[model samples]
Target: MPTTEPGRRRRPRASTVIVGALLTVGALVTAFPFLWMLFASVKPRGESVAYPPHLIPSEPTFEFFAQLFNELDFGRYLVNTLAIVAICMLGLLLMAAAGYGFAKFTFPGRDALFFLVLATMMIPGQVTMIPSFLIINGLNLTNTLIGISLPMLVSGFAVFLFRQFMATIPTEVLEAARMDGAGEWRIFFSIVLPMSGPILAVQVVLTFIAGWNSFLWPLIIANDQKLYTLSVGVSLLNQQIATNPSLQMAASTLMVVPILIVFVVFQRYVVQGFTLSGLK
Candidate 1:
């Protein structure tokens, strides 16, 4: 009998090719503005505004960035941003503990209480701003980092995400720990938290991004020029020097870089966290 010829290599399906092409186009479109900013920040002022909008710097310079840091007092703003972001991280830990309590512990009116927590999320931040401002001011926290950070400490969304994720922990684990004479706090801090790495990373990235982008609360609360976060500072800068593309682009880059780094560092865990938590 004649030997059978080897099968020819299979080609990618037309649907796969089309889907990949569409996705590539979508990614380019999404990234175009960021790529533009990164380029424009380094470009000569005239070149930043030239026809066709340069995506690559012809004569890269750090002049605008220098102005931002040296002349514009952005160093103080940066320090303020970092300090607030750090406090937000601390708030996340507290939220995680609360989430653990909600997830594992049985209590009276548990569902109703949790519902109330979720209800708070429905109220827009704008509506609450005036009240929050008054309360902070009454407490003598206005124009202080503490006042700016009070709103960052905990959120209904954080609790919900943590509770959802923590629910996946087995009841047997907690019971066994209790049988071994471990305290509730010990079980939570040691076992539950260590096991919650993915969701923690997810929440961390979310919280940091939110804190970094927080403009309204900080703007209203922080009357002191020393306490301006990047968003508030850059916005004011925009008002004063709206004509300078390079400075604006540099400020935009400053606002975005931290968020990008954070997401990149935690990107893998984010999807995993959502999947484990049964979130869509």
Candidate 2:
């Protein structure tokens, strides 16, 4: 056993302290924009862009938020975004099931098929945008929430994430379940999925953020004002209230809140999922 000299104590190195300070500074810098936005969101309209900007609002009010909800129909946009998120989350579960199949099943050409699926990730989304639009047009889904959400139903990244995470499961446990005569679906839904909470939380947070923040595809598909998601609706609100920085900030704050809440809640699971997946 290693022993320290009597009356001697170890202390963190100077380099460690310096690194800690630097990291603290970095975190503060990263968080500044969000702090600024929150403060600005409550400020009176004229004070938002005043010279020598203040970090704290002098006269805070909820008038801008009221305007955002009442004049801009932001409530409707929130409902549309929530509906789309629900649909996309169901699709993500299907994607996870497919990933579980890829991870656990032994099939001919399985490796080749998975490789092909991963290869799709390398293709830029822009390349398929026009073709996807044409297909949606053909289906007469234009201006519909379903059309806006169709392209986001599945993606190579989500499949790959679930596959990697699922690969970490112990095969012996699955074999034991098989010995008990459990059907494949029963084993998967009851045994496998319940044990995959971390990765599932990771997927939920990621898919929610993506679905909430989706702008371009939604804009292209849902030309109808009533069908606009929060992202599109906020952009139009910004355009109409271009001169009102307070209102813009208020709208932006609303847009950011859901994603922030999701991250704060599931960040631990995200870290655990990534760590376990990397080990696999």
Candidate 3:
């Protein structure tokens, strides 16, 4: 009998290649305007708007950015935005943790109370905006970081996400912890939270991005330029763009960079959080 020739197996391939390629293209397209904004921010004044514009500046300069800082109070805006983002993130983490507890643990009217909280998510932010502003104004929080962070503190979406993830934790683990005399708070803080690392990371990134990009509320509530967030500051710069497009782009550049850095760093955690939360 003739020895049979060994068969060659076709190279294995995953559809991820095609999916990734398409996603890459989509991401590039989505990112093009931002790339242009960065390029425009650094390009010489006239070049930013040259007919048939330049994607890659012939020569880039930071002069516009310098102008932005010198002429506009960009630094104050930067501080304000950073402060609000930090405060809001801290508050959101705590609120989400509490919401996770409400969903996973039993207590009198727990289900009813959680349902009431969930119902708030159905109400549009716009509907609550005016009332929230009035409350903040009444409390002398207008033009304050606390005002900006307060309405955003208890995020309904964050609560819902945390609750979903926490529900996936095994009851056996909680029972074991309880057998060892772990209180509800102890079990949640020690056992439940450690397992929730991925969701918390996701919430942090999401809440930071949302807080960082918050425009309308900041614009409405912040009357003093000293208290203006990047979004409001950039809008204020827009009114004078006819005289200074370069400066405006430079301000826009500032407004966008922090969020970009954040997304790049925490993107993996965000994806993992979505995966875990979606499971149940």
Q: What total of clashing residue pairs does each candidate reach?
A: 0, 0, 0
Tens-digit lDDT string for candidate 1 (176-274): 999999998899889999999999999999989988998989988877888989899888886766588989989999999989999999999998998
Please provide, for model 2 over 219-280, each residue's C-alpha lDDT reduced to its tens digit, 9 standing for 90 to 100.
87876788988988878864775578888888899999879899999999999988887754
With a 3 Å backbone cut-off (N, CA, C), the pairs that clash in candidate 2 are none
Q: Is candidate 1 or candidate 2 better by lDDT?
A: 1
Provide the overall lDDT of each model, using Cα atoms, as 2-decimal numbers: 0.90, 0.89, 0.82
Give per-model TM-scores.
0.94, 0.91, 0.86
Residue 170, model 2: Cα distance from true site in angstroms:
1.8
lDDT of 3: 0.82
Question: If both were scored by TM-score, which would come out higher, candidate 1 or candidate 3?
Answer: 1
Per-residue CA lDDT of model 3 for 1-280, tens digit only, reads 8564579555446787788889999999999988888888888877876888778888889987786667777777788888988888777657767766776777898888778888998999999999999999999999888998899888777887888888888989999999999997888779888898888888788788888888899888987768888787788775755666667777877877877787788888878989989854
List where candidate 3 sits over 4 angstroms from the true fold: 1-27, 240-243
Candidate 1 lDDT for residue 3: 57
**Residue 85 deviation, candidate 2, in Å?**
0.8
Per-residue error (Å), model 3, residue 108: 2.4
- Residue 22 lDDT, candidate 2, scale 0-100: 100
Residue 202 of model 1: what lDDT?
95
